[model samples]
Each structure stands twice: as structure tokens, then as C-alpha cells.
Target: MIIRKATHTDIPSLVILMNNFRKFYQQESNTEEVKSFLKERMDKGNSVIFVAILEDKLVGYTQLFPSFSTIKLEKIWILNDLFISEKFRGLGVASQLLTRVLKFSQETHRHQVWLLTGNDNKSAQHLYRKIGFTNTKFKHYVYNF
Candidate 1:
């Protein structure tokens, strides 16, 4: 398996993985929209995406968006998406992807990498904790438009 940053050439394979990820979250599947969104992000260079390839096949990916922390007065990263193909699960692919993200954050001197998972996602929670991420006391809230 190989882990590396995503490039323009990756968008096609990424779209499939992204669609599957959305489906896992109960989101509607829209390949064109996913492609457009990813293209925009790539064109703008506003986000960082990493992909895992195993035997020449894209197996997993994780995306991080840039943000800033007022208290830290420095940049931070929101680890927005992480998905491994169903067949690739339990193979340490997710952990490898996350390790890459943390390495990236360190290399870029970011304050931290933040991520949120559904409360019901116990498996993800377990993996995160096992990888050294601690549960925070802070509450996360969002207001949908």
C-alpha cells in the first residue's frame, strides 16, 4: 500500500470513494456534483487531500480544510473526510491515512487537526482513541440553513 497526497489525476477515483463515503453517511449520491466540488477545491488549493493506493487501486482517502484558531493565533486543519473502501477496512488503511494527516499538520506547523464523527460511530471512535486522539470536553454545534 502507498500513501500520498492527491493530485489532479486522482479526482476520478476519488469521486467513487467520495460517493461511497456520502452513502455511508446517508447522503445522496451525485457523481457530477462530487466531481465539480472536488475540482473547485483543487483549483482553489484551499484543501489538502491524501489518498491511499493499494496495488494500483485507490483504496482510501482523507481530506482536510484550512482554518484558523483565534486563541492559538495560528492555522489549524479540519479533517473533514476519511473513508476506506469496504474491502479495505480493518487493514490499517484509515490509521495510515490519519498518520499522514498528522505528519502533514506537523510539517506545516499547524496548531492541530480537528475532526468530528457521529456519536453512533463507535468503530471510528475506537480507532481514533487507539490512535492517540482524546475525546474533548468542548461541544460541537451547527445550524443548518
Candidate 2:
């Protein structure tokens, strides 16, 4: 398996994986919208995406968006998305992708990386804890428009 940053050439395969990810979260599937959203992010360089390829096939991916931490007075990363194909699960693909993200964050001198997962996602929570991420005391809240 190989882990690397995603390029424009990767958008097609990425769309499939991203759609699957959304489906897992009970979101509606819209390939056209997914394509457009990914294209915009890639074209604008607004986010960092990494892909995992196994035997020449895209098997997994993770995406991170840049943000600032006012308390730390430094840049931080929101690890927004991570998904491994069902067949590729438990093969350490997710770990490899996350390792790459953390390495990139360190290289860029970011203050920290933050991510949230549903309480029911035990597998993901386990992997994240194994990777040295700790549960925070603060609660997260969002107001939908």
C-alpha cells in the first residue's frame, strides 16, 4: 500500500470514496455535487487531502482543513474526513493516512489537529486513541442555518 497527497488526477476515485463516506454518515449521495465540491477545494488549495493506494487502486483517503486557534495563537488543522473502503478496513490503511496527516501538520508547524467522530463509531475512536489522540473535556456545538 502507498500513501500520498492527492492530486487532480485523483478526484474521480476520491469522489467514490467520499460518497461512500457520506453514505456511512447517512448523508444523501450526489455525485455531481461531490465532484464540484472536491474540484473547488482542490483548485483553491483550501484543504489538504491524502490518498492511500493499494495495488494501483485508491483504497482510502483523509482530508484536513486549515483553521486558526485563537487560544494558541497559531494555525491548526481540522481532520474533517477519513474513509477506507470496506474491503480495506482493518489493514492499517486508516492509520497510514492519519500518520501522513500528522506528519504534514508537524512539518508545517501547526499547533494541533482536531477531529470529531460519532459516539457510535467505536472502530474509529479506537484507532484515534491508539494514535495518541485524547478525548477533550470541552463540548462541541454547531448551529445549522
Candidate 3:
């Protein structure tokens, strides 16, 4: 298994995996649409993505958006997306991707990183805990209009 930050050439596979991730959240998104969105983001330096591969096949990925925290007076990384393909769920793909994210944060000297997952997703919660994200009592209050 190999894990690394994604590049423009990896966009196609990344998009497909992102579409699957959306479907898991009940969103009906197309791969082409995802690809286009990702392409624009890449060109604009809007976000970061890390992909996990096995035997030359893309298996999973995690994406983070660079944001700022006034309180910390530093950059904040919103761990926006994480998806391990169905075929790779039992493997260590998600763990590896998250490790990469944390390492990236440390290397970049970012303020901090955070992610939100549904309360019922016990498996994901377990993974997050196993990865050492504990005691993060941060609450999400979103008002989308």
C-alpha cells in the first residue's frame, strides 16, 4: 500500500472516489462533475487531497480545505472529506490517509485540523479515535441559506 498527496494527474481517479463518497452521504453526483470541480480547485490551490493506492490501484482518499482561525491566528485545515472504497474498507487506507494529513499539518505548521462525522458512524468514530483525535469537543453550528 502507498499513500501520498494527490496531483493533477491523479484527479480522474480522485474524482471517481469522491463521487462514491458523495453517494455514501446520499448525494447523487457525477464523476465528471467531481473531476471538473477538483480540477478547478487544483488550479486555484483551494484544497489538499491525499490518496491511498495498492498495487497501482487507487483505493481511498481524504481531502482538506485550508481555512483560517482567528483565535489561533494560524491556518486551519478542515478535513472536508474522507473515503475508502468499499473494496478497501477493511484495509488500512483511511488510517494511512489520516496519518498523512496529520503529518502534512505538522510539516506545514498549520494551526490545527478537524473533521466531523455522523454520530452513528461508529466505524469512522473508531478510526478517528484510533488515529488519536480525542477530546475534541468542538461543535458544528451551520446555517446554510
lDDT comparison, 1 vs 2, better candidate: 2
**lDDT tens digits, residues 49-139, model 2?**
9999997999999999999989889999999999999998999999999999999999999979999998899999999999999998889
lDDT score of residue 27 within candidate 3: 89
lDDT of 3 by residue, 32-140 (tens): 8898899998899889888899979999999999888887798889999999989888888888898899999999888688898877889999999988887565777
Clashes of each: 0, 0, 0
Q: Which residue runs of candidate 2 sit more than 4 Å off their true CA positions? A: none
Candidate 3: lDDT of 58?
92
Candidate 3, residue 18: how far the Cα is off, in Å = 0.4
Best by TM-score: 2
lDDT of 2 at 49: 96
Q: Rate the local accuracy (lDDT) of all candidates.
A: 0.95, 0.96, 0.88
Runs of candidate 1 with Cα error greater than 4 angstroms are none
By TM-score, how accurate is candidate 3?
0.92
Compared with the true structure, what per-residue lDDT tens digits does model 1 show for residues 1-24? 899999999999999999999999
What's model 1's overall lDDT?
0.95
Put the candidates in TM-score order, highest first. 2, 1, 3
TM-score of 1: 0.97
